[model samples]
Target chain A: MKETLKLFKIGGGVLDDDAQLHRFVQAFAQVPGRKILVHGGGKGASQMLSDLGIAPQMVQGRRITDAATLDVVTMFYAGKTNKQLVALLQASGVNALGLSGADGNVIRAVKRPVKDIDYGFVGDLPANSVDAATLHTLIQAELTPVLCAITHDGHGQLLNTNADTIASTVARALAGRYEVELHYCFEKNGVLLDVNDDNSVIPQIVPAQYQQLKADGVIAAGMIPKLDNAFAALEAGVEKVVIEHALNINEPIKTVLCRS
Target chain B: MKETLKLFKIGGGVLDDDAQLHRFVQAFAQVPGRKILVHGGGKGASQMLSDLGIAPQMVQGRRITDAATLDVVTMFYAGKTNKQLVALLQASGVNALGLSGADGNVIRAVKRPVKDIDYGFVGDLPANSVDAATLHTLIQAELTPVLCAITHDGHGQLLNTNADTIASTVARALAGRYEVELHYCFEKNGVLLDVNDDNSVIPQIVPAQYQQLKADGVIAAGMIPKLDNAFAALEAGVEKVVIEHALNINEPIKTVLCRS
Candidate 1:
């Protein structure tokens, strides 16, 4: 049996609040074992962009990443937020190494192709994008890696990538060498059966049940893509997938997704 | 016998110019042996701060790093400049790892004490600040570490620091294990006998000669502190300190400072 590696990803909600971010960091540090952290860009980046007078570029309904927006997001995610998390983790006795994808050539991505819209500096990860070997060495050396949502093409262009995609891609890449557990921590407790009720979290979710739930309108439209992505990670041999509140990661009232 | 390690420090001259920075990166990748790169923040940070309406705080002619200034500098130095260098180096076939002091707790710092001047969020590195053992491990693994001018107090505050100080401090710390060569690269050819003549590069200067040059009014008052810092590094066991043009590092026409 291989060693277990827990990979936790947090989104904008926890990151936007300092107190909540610190609380999450404390909880994350207490998770005993080899672990990794992936963080998304918060309102800070967008706020900075707005302050700098750079308007958001939207094509249809989707926000497109322009050159200026890319610059701001890169600074916020990789520079401020990443370093802050690393320092906070260090204070809690975890030797956290912060990284962008360009660091150690950990993740090489390609710029998204122009189809109907040209997302100026957005990156999309393909197969074999993550450098699993180097990451394995870092983890085995007792260093917890904290990755930001910034990647680069091998030819010197930095691109903004989706944090969830990065987390799942890394987990999938490491699945062959370790029993990987992918955790998505967000504002909500878990995948709630009733959207309005906070106490209606489904404890366990499997593929068949998930499909049935979607078909019967138990899961909403917004959650389909997320669940699909999670199921894909499970199919790729990740041991388990988890969805929980960023602040209550240690608590048991969360949903766990298994292959069975 | 320990291996030779070359540590190069580059400032705004190269960082502000894209062609010059890429040229330096190409040159850096071709150099043989274990190496590290420490870069100073460029004018982009200040420009961004200005555009964002944050006025720089100054005290008695020296720039003070207040909270807002610290935030912009951190994002610019650690985010844009560091990642850009890393990506360029990777494209040149070097496995470059970008770091702020907070990453891996590699360099812990203390907030500058408020005395006659309150330099808000500025950090001062004390003894045993650099984690040389971890650096040695990274170098041994054949990864070139690129550090920016951002550090952290172990209690989670990211503080802006001086790049030259960071470079020299790292050189002094790593002197015990590696025969270290510290190079400070800038726009000038070298220390000049005639301040106005770019071609009058002084080949070498020892401590005694440096003092005499100062007394003779040959060296400018501004160059005194830099030379003093370089000589201190030599006295602290750093093998050599070189000052040269950033783009002309591979050329031989430069100044080498010795402790003798």
Candidate 2:
């Protein structure tokens, strides 16, 4: 039996608010066993860009990560937010080591190939992108890696990547050595039965039930892609995937997705 | 017999200029041995602060690292500059891993105590600040750690430290395990005999010679503190302390300080 490794991802909602971010860090520190925290870029980067007279370019609803934008976001996510989170976790007695994918060549990504629209400096993860062996060494050394949503192409390019994709890829890659638990933590309690009802969280979700939930229109449209990625990770040998509130990670009132 | 470890430090002049920084990284990647790079904050951080409308506050001669300044410097040093250097080094075939002292608890520092003046958010490293054992492991792993001058109080506060101090402390700490060589790379070719003559480079300087040169006013007044620190490291068992030009590491025109 392999040791349990919990991987938690926190998105922009919790990251944008200082009070909420501190609360989440406190809760995350309390999570027992070896763990890693993957954080998404918050509104801070965009705000900095606008403040610096740089207008964000978007096409077909997807933001374009140009050269200037990549520089700002890299500073914000990998620099300010990542170091702050690591400091806070350290204050709470957690031995957290912050990382950008470029740090140890831990996650080498490819620049998203231009198709209909050019995504400037955005990166996409391919097979064998995550360096699981190095991560295993860091974890076995008792360091919790706090990863930001920034990676690099091996040949000198730092590319911005989606945090969710990074989390799932890392979990799947590490599954060979550990029982991986991928947690998606956000504002909501769990996968909701009704979008308006905060208390309508389903306790557990399986792939079969997840398919039925999608057919019945119970799951939100925005959440479908996340769940699809989660299920795909489960298929790829990740032991479990959980969706819960960032603040309520230690609680039981959450949704767990299993292979069943 | 212990293996040799080369620790190089680059300050503001090289770091502020992109072309110069690239040249330095290229030269650094070619250095053959276990190595580490320590980088100082450039004018970019202050430029960002000024661009964002934060006037820098100076107490006496030293700049105060207020909360806002700390944030910008952290992002600039750890985020933009560190990652850029890492990417560039990786491109040049060096396995460079960027780190703030907070990462891996590699260097823990104490907040500069309030004395005649309070330098807010500034850190001063004391004895045993650098975790040499962990660094040894990282070097043994064939990873060149690219360190920024950002550290944390083990209790959670991220503090801005002097890059030169960080390099010296790291070199001294690792002295017991390796034949450590500390290199301070700047704009000049080396310690010069004539202030106006770049070609009058002192190829070597021993402690007795350094004292006589200082007595005769051959060394510039500004180079005193840096040379003092360099000699101090030589005293602390670091095998050699080299004062060289950032872009001329591969060349032989530099000063080497020795115990003899």
Q: Name the docking class for model 2.
A: medium
**Winner by DockQ:** 1
Task: Summarize candidate 1's per-residue lDDT along B1-260 as a digit string, tens digits.
Answer: 98899999999979998899989999899889999999999888989898988988889988999888888898999999999899999999999999999888889999999999888899999999999988887888788999999999999889999999999999999999999999999889999999999999999999899988999999977888888999999999999999999998889999999876
lDDT of 2: 0.93
Question: TM-scores of the models, in the given order?
Answer: 0.98, 0.98
lDDT string for model 1 (A105-178, tens) is 99999999999988889999999999999899788778899999999999999999999999999999999999
lDDT of 1 at A53: 85
Candidate 2's displacement at residue A78, Å, is 0.7
DockQ per model, Cα: 0.85, 0.80
RMSD of each: 1.2, 1.1
Model 2, total clashes: 0
Model 2 ranges off by over 4 Å = none
TM-score of 2: 0.98
Residue B86's lDDT within candidate 2 is 90
